[model samples]
Target: MKHLLLGAAALAVTASMALAGGHSVVRMGTEGAYEPWNFINDAGEIDGFERELGDELCKRAELTCEWVKNDWDSIIPNLVSGNYDTIIAGMSITAERDEVIDFTQPYTPPDPSAYVALDAGLDVEGAVIAAQATTIQAGFIAEKGWTLIEFATPEETVAAVRNGEADAVLADKSFLDTVAGTDGLVMLDRMEAIGGGVGMGLRESDAELRAKFDAAITSMKEDGTLNALIAKWEVASQF
Candidate 1:
């Protein structure tokens, strides 16, 4: 749900700094918060499934790439404003977002959406659901006419459910699984698909760059490298 809304561009100057050796930099922006997809490790580096995948794609494309951490809610806007050249974050390939930015052919297929709650008493149809703002999960809650509580980040949404601010949180099952296992949370019996597949977001002007990554992803798929990464991350859903 953490859709990029351009609130400010004060960091544009720093973001536009060039790479050395006359090599064009392909800065990869990610929300370094969500785990298993992309998250900051103890060493203070972006480390996760997307991290590994991004490096592989960059190597295959022969791009001089670097990771850029951006807040999830502003990720898309920063990319549009040139803070980064690509988004290696776990962004879904949705029609609404496609209108604003181009997406590579999906590397991660759409995983099922699940509802996690502290308990089973809340009526999902009428209960207040927590979702990160501007996400498909948030849209789904709104579409169902459920009272939706919006948060700026996924952690905040899950925290809302823990704090009784929401009856449940709707999110990707892989993500919810991590939180549910340790925090006394539980998945409800409701599960569904909300969006298409997950892909890297790119600027519409970066068609050539998108093609490079797409080709690399296709190669990985053909050789089973992509599935290996998915399985390694325990995000086993495949196209």
Candidate 2:
């Protein structure tokens, strides 16, 4: 599989125009591939932590919201291009990403990153590691000077491990749990939480929209509603 490098984000130079005042219908984009956080359920609807959280946020922000499913690799650029007003895809908050898009305060706490493979143990430093493109895990592998194989979606990374295309797949421990413990794949008994909490991604120019969602996220964080959702999805640790 061809792996795209991080420079793909350099295309997100388009500035978002100001949204009209008042609560207009807003569009929320998600990968709909990463489970528990966001995924397509049997009915083919977007269902998961982010779906519920995004809906509640829109209600609290007093905006009519619609869901937009986009491939993981293009989510950010699409948001910058006005394809969506907000990104509720389980996107991590990082300084590199912050330069391209702004983020709301964390809704889900950081998750431990894990190495999982068909083999129980592998040489992380020398083994080929698969990670979803544009994620913290992918960056970590590069920073560690390890061979990194990038995929457009989380499922593809895991599949690479299963297909013996990669030595291991590095991703959120919780996400890997859904695949590892059940798919004959095993977690490497080694892992690390390498980034901050997951948050909503908005265009850098959408300060007003970011603020509105930030306030809504703050409300959730204050009320224990966010904790309930965290437990509900079993995605990661709570704030």
Among these predictions, the greatest lDDT belongs to 2
**Which lDDT values do the candidates have, in the order given?**
0.81, 0.82
At residue 211, candidate 1 shows an lDDT of 86
Regions more than 4 Å wrong, model 2:
1-12, 20-23
Question: Model 2 over residues 1-239: C-alpha lDDT tens digits?
Answer: 11123355545458547752543778899889888788999999999989999999989988789999998777777888888888888777777677777888888878888889887857788899999886778878899999999988788898998888999999888788788776688989898758877888887778898899999999988999989998988888778
- Candidate 1 stretches greater than 4 Å from native: 1-23
Top TM-score model? 2
Q: What is the RMSD of candidate 2?
A: 2.9
Clashing pairs in 2: none
